[model samples]
Every structure is written in C-alpha cells, then in structure tokens.
Target: MSSATSLPIIFVEEGALAAANLSAAHRAWADANGFTGQRGRLLALPDPQGGLAGHLFGTGPVADRPPLVAAQAGAVIGPGQFHFQGASGDPTLAALGFRLGAYRFDRYRAGKPAPVLDLPAGADADEVDRLVSGAALARDLINTPANDLGPDALDQTIRSFAADRGMECRAIVGDDLLAAGFPMIHAVGRASAQAPRLLDLTWGNPDDPKVTLVGKGVTFDTGGLDIKPASGMLLMKKDMGGAANVLGLAHAIVSAKLRLRLRVLIPVVENAISGTSFRPSDVLTSRKGLTVEIGNTDAEGRLILADALALADEESPALLLDMATLTGAARVALGPELPPLYSTDDELARALMAAGTASDDPLWQMPLWSPYDAMMSSKVADVNNAGTGGFAGSVTAALFLRRFVDNAAAWVHLDIFGWAPEARLARSQGGTDQGIRAVYGVLKQRYPAA
Candidate 1:
C-alpha cells in the first residue's frame, strides 16, 4: 500500500504528549480524549471529514521502555495496512516486534486475520523474516499437545524439517539407543509406549567451522516413577521446548546461510510412568561412560541432555550450545521472561548478553559456580542427577551436564522457561521462543555471510 493511504502510527513518549508535534486540531482532540501517553495507551486520530486518519501510541518513558514496545501496536491495531510515522525506538526491532506481535497459535481454533504492517525504512526485510519464521516454528512446536507430539512424532517432525532443508537427518531408536551407548536415554524413555530416540542432523559445509547444538527433548514429562503433581503435569507437554527452540535457531541460521558447519543433536523421550519405568536410585550409564544415579525421575531433562552434550563434545566443535527447560530453580531465580545463561567462555557469554539486549530477547548470565558441583555427588554412581541440598538446583543441573563435556572449544548452556505465563507487548500467553534470537545475533556477528 502507498504511504498516502496506509494508516500512520505516531509514537508518543510518556509525559511528552503536549510537545508531540501534532497539528493544533489533533492536539486538541488528544487533550480532549485525555491521552497521557501511558504505555500501551492507543488513541485513534481523525481527519477533517471525521474519518480515520492515524493512531497515537504511547511508548512510555525512554529510559524504561523496551525496544519492542512498538509491538503493542500490532496487537491492538485492527485490520489495515499501517506504517510507523515517527517512531523513536530502534526501527528494525520495532518492525520485527510488529511482525511478532501479529503471531497467533490458532491451530486448534479459528482466529482473526492479522493486520498488515508495512516494513519500516532501514529494517532488513530478510533478517526480520528469518527471525519471525524461527520464532513461529518454535512456538508452534512448543504449543502442540503431547498426544500429538510424542517422541516418535518429534522424530518424524525433525526428519521432515531436515528433508525440506536438504540436511542429512538420522535417528537411533529403542533398543538401538542401548546399542549406541545411550543407556540413560533408553532408561528414561523405555517405560513409555513410544520408544526413545536420538535425532541427528547435519548441514552446511563440513570444511567450515563446526558449531554444534544439543537440546533436551522430553516431549511429555509425566515424571516417570516420580510422577509430578497434577498441577505440574498441566504444562508437561511443553517439556520439549528446548528442542523446539534450538530447531528454531537452526532455521534462522540456515535461512541466513551463515558460514559454519552446523550439527544438531536432540535426545527425544517421554518421562512416562509404566511397569518398566526407571525408578529413583537407579544408576544408568550415559553415552560418555559416566554412570548417573537418578535422585529424582523428575530431573530427567538433564539426563537426556547429558548424553547429547557428550556426543556433541566428542566432535570438539568450535562452539557448543545447549538449551533446555531444565529446572524450577532457574524460574525461581529469574522469572520466565529472562533465561539464565551459563558458559565456560566469558567472551561468548558477554556477546550473547549484548545481543539479547539489542534483540529484545534478554538473557541473564548465571555463573557455573564450580563449588556447587559437589551438590550432585552420588555414593553408588559417578554423579547424582539431582542436587542434594536443593539450594542451588539450577546450578547443580548445569554442573551435572558439565561433567560430560571435555573437548569442545567453548560451550554455553541456556535454562529457558519457554512459556509466557501472561500476555505481553509482542508475546502471547502461551509457548514462546527465548534466547534463540540473542544466539542468532551473535552467530550473525561471528559467522557473517561471505
């Protein structure tokens, strides 16, 4: 649509409405309407003919306003083509937020059509599309129910994704997991009707710098023999959010055609209760030859991730990253919006943090805290899968996974909630993507297109 016909979105900073550069008539209208530029406050502007002309959106104060605050416009605007007239925030992030805010998970129900937003000037269209596509894929996968997205289903989905991208994909299933030295993965998922599997996907030029990603793929966490309470099981379907998010990040990297050899490892399983369910105190051998004592069957995400991380480390990739919805302690430490990042490399962590701030994906760095490693000691095995004191649950989980990595050049781990407890400016109240955008931003910087 032409700029003349499209609705213009005029952003107003909080407490600056009086000096908002509005025409005398429009200013009078805003004053009469008591528009104070409160965050998320939207006021419709009219032309001389009493017809719709534009909209006034409050961005709140500059100091506290988020980069994606412009996303609020996408959520509130009706069906029409709109463009930013005088937005003061980062234009690229604003445009990206506008697109993200228009996202909806309507697979099981009908929803309204999304309003169109003309791409703002200076925004990279390709980059925006890549990020949006990745986020949507992750959200859709996380939002799917367990009944339809079990281990086998997840395996198939990954295979299809690989095929579409021309990536080589393979899976080692059921008894094959044991044959392949993934005893912990088999033990954790053996009880379920759906067999456990480890999915591997490879893409890009093998001669390029190796970048490996591992994700915990517990499709549905019933907590096995240590079943979770009914309230905890309510959102168990999202247990595989880690796998979903990594795939989303992978998509962005491939779509951008970054110069790196990418490898993705996902240990897919369902922590279900059955006659063959793995019990607490069972010592299971991992892919890396370390025996892990199951302190609590509910702590199964780390178990599967340990095996995958071990496999990734074996290649000694230049960069190793893993994402998981691992511990409740992480949530207690830093709510759902901010995922905690743990890295062996300080430079990598700092880069990720900066990228998160710039991309509006926000990540907080949490130390690996080597002192907490003792909390996972086991009397009968190499290590216990759960913490002893329960004081540093998240720290101990990160420490447990660290035991399996010895060869990677640099490694980073993200403990993400993967769910939005409440609706926000650019995010819905359901499954969402975390940390991927920040990681992608860093990747773009590290491995820019040739």
Candidate 2:
C-alpha cells in the first residue's frame, strides 16, 4: 500500500511501543523527543532541512478494536493526506475516526483546513465517505440554531436533498396536515408562525423491500403552553436532532444505493408558545385515530412522531425505525453518549447491538415493558401524552410510540439525547449525531448491494 498524497501514520499504544519498528534514525528522533506512546500523544519528526517528515499517533494496543483515537492524527498532523503504515486495529474505523475527529462546524466562522487521509488498503472509500458525510450532515443540522432551521427550512432541505438524488419528495404543510389526518403534528406545530409540516422522501425500486424511517423534527421546543425554564430552553434548538439523524442515515442508504426501498418521514414542527398553543388536558386526535390527552406539552416529540409512525406503519414496511430526542429520562438512564433502543424482536436487537458495538455508535437495549402500558392510560382520551408518574418515563414513551406501530415486520425506537453535553477525545462538545452511524452499519450489513 503506497500513496503519494498521504503521509505514513505509525500507531503506538502504552506499554508496547511501536517505535521499535521504525528505522533507527526515526526511532532515535522519537526517543530524543521524549515520545512514550501514551494514548493521544503525537510525535512529528522533521527532516534535516526542517521540511516534511512522517508522524507517530499514540493509540491503544494493536489488539484493541478500531475507532481507536486515530482521530488525533487529524487533530495533530499538518495539512495533508495520510495513510496507515502499520496495524492499528481496523484501518477503516481508524480512517473514520480521523475524519470524524477532524470535523469542525465552522458554518459561521472561518476555520483552518484539517488533514485528510488517503484511503487505506482494505478500506472501502465509499463506505468511509458515506458514514463520515452522514454524521457530518447530522452534526451541522443539529448545531445550527433554530432561527435558521425552522420547520419551513427543514421542508426545503428535504426537498433539496430529494431533488439532488432524483428521489420523490413532498411536504404536507400547515392546515394540510389537518386535512391529511396528521392532527397531532398540526396540533403541536400550529401555534408557531412557521406552521407544522411533514416532510417525506422516497427512493429505490417499488419492488424492493420497504424500509421506513420516521424522525421527530421539532425545530425548537419552547414546551408550548407548558413552558420550559429559561435554562431548559437554551438547548431546545437541537430538538430536531431526530430529523437530522434520519436525513444523515437516509443519505448513506441512498448514496450507497442499498438494495431496499427507503422512505423517510419527518414531522417538522416547533413547540412554541402562543395564545393558540394547544393546552394541557387537551384531547388531540392522531393520524392513527387514537386520542391523546396532553399530560405535559413538553412531551411533544412523541405526539408528532405518533402521527408519522402511524402513517409509516400503514405500509407494513419490512423495517420501521424512528429516532427522537424524546425523553430526558433516557439521558438519565444511559447518559448522553449511548442511546437506548426499544425493540421486541430479539434477532433485530442482537444485530443492532452488534453493529453498534462494532461501529462505536453504541446503544443500550431497553425493554418495551408491557406492565408500563397502563401508566399512559388517560381518563379523557385513549392515551395520555406522558405518564402520570416520572418513573420509567423513557419506557412509557417507547410504549406510547409502540401503539402507533403494529404493521411493520420489525420496529425499533431510539430514545436519543442527540447532544454531547461535553467534549470527548474525537468528538467536540455540543450537538452530536448519536446512534445513526451504528444504525447505518446495521443496514449496510443487512442490505448490501449485489
């Protein structure tokens, strides 16, 4: 494996030094520089002319799996392309980490260009590009403020994305939502001047297996009539993270030209406050024809998703997956990095768990416990938007969405935090695209192209 565009990357872990394999001159240079192979440590050797030379990236042992902090290579190395010179676990994942770690949401400001990677031997360029691009798109969407990414803007985005790929796309906006039977979506979004809408994009042959994905697209959550505290509302802009993740994964599927028919449904809305905002105890009819009493307006993500999921389930797709920043209890349960997955099918659960682990986009499985079903029972309607008690909030939310999904061969609901509360080695602090890459990895394995 030789490349002109990329510099050589040598990975070293603590205890076992890989510097020993380097030429005596380079090894001596590394030792002179006090490079000890600790994780995230980088040593760049200079040529005698003080020009370009190779680099050393500190990482976990070779036996450890990838997504190893190879991202540090991008962060530390100067502008240029690079390739792996030695085994650092999975080269593909290492490349992905490098790309992801190199990411910067500089939409509003000018930033320096980061180092690039020459695709390594055995690494699929398309796969790595698709995954990194998907995550990058999601991160950009989430990081953008609500003022610029409202429901109407999101609608235009879906249209533009579909147009570029020659996919069928449409939006049922404002009052049309009421006429189309998506009452919950309209109810949640109607108060905003922006108007609520459902954005739909379809691709692939009709004869192929159907896979429908639904996302909660609340552009901003003011908590409607039941307002959130000023502190709580600060990060409300990322309420649309579910929509971002779906679009990201959809991009991967369509770009890779997978073997399944794909449909993306996003109920775009803004849970804003106004005189017309839906009130607490209000009974709203959903697309599924189920009536839900508003237990708490802040629990609005599930309302919009309920209607969209009902619409998607009507097709009895082979797979139905919905992602949402739906519950704080989920963050409490699994924290921000790991999204909780709810699914009844053990096989699908196993596959998703395996894919998530392998891809480093981890999810913890949470049961759709039937006992919690009664907790959402409403005195005035078919169901309550939220549970009466705070306990098992995430579980009850998953169960609530489950009612709208019966026809799909398999249904998985992801309760995702969608925001990284703080920064990590490769990931910057703020809105992150959680669980999507892992989901895409599963889809790739399940529906590989011929």
The number of the candidate with the highest TM-score is 1
For model 2, the stretches where C-alpha displacement exceeds 4 angstroms are 1-6, 18-20, 23-25, 32-34, 63-65, 76-78
Q: Model 1, residue 320: what's the lDDT?
A: 96
- After superposition on all CA atoms, how large is the RMSD of candidate 2? 1.8
Pairs of colliding residues, candidate 2: 6-81
Alpha-carbon TM-score of each model against the true structure = 0.96, 0.95
Q: Which candidate leads in lDDT?
A: 1
Expressed as tens digits, the lDDT of each residue in 1-450 for candidate 2 is 547655787777765555448777877887788776767777886777986677887775545535637776765566777777665667688778888878888888988777777777787778888888888888899999998998888888889988998899988999999989999999999999999999888999999999999999999999888899899999999999999999999989998999999999999999998888999999998888888999999999999999999999999999999999999999889888889999867789878988888777888899999999999999889999889778999999999999999899999999988787876645667788877777888888889876
Question: Model 1 off-target regions past 4 Å?
Answer: 1-5, 18-23, 47-51
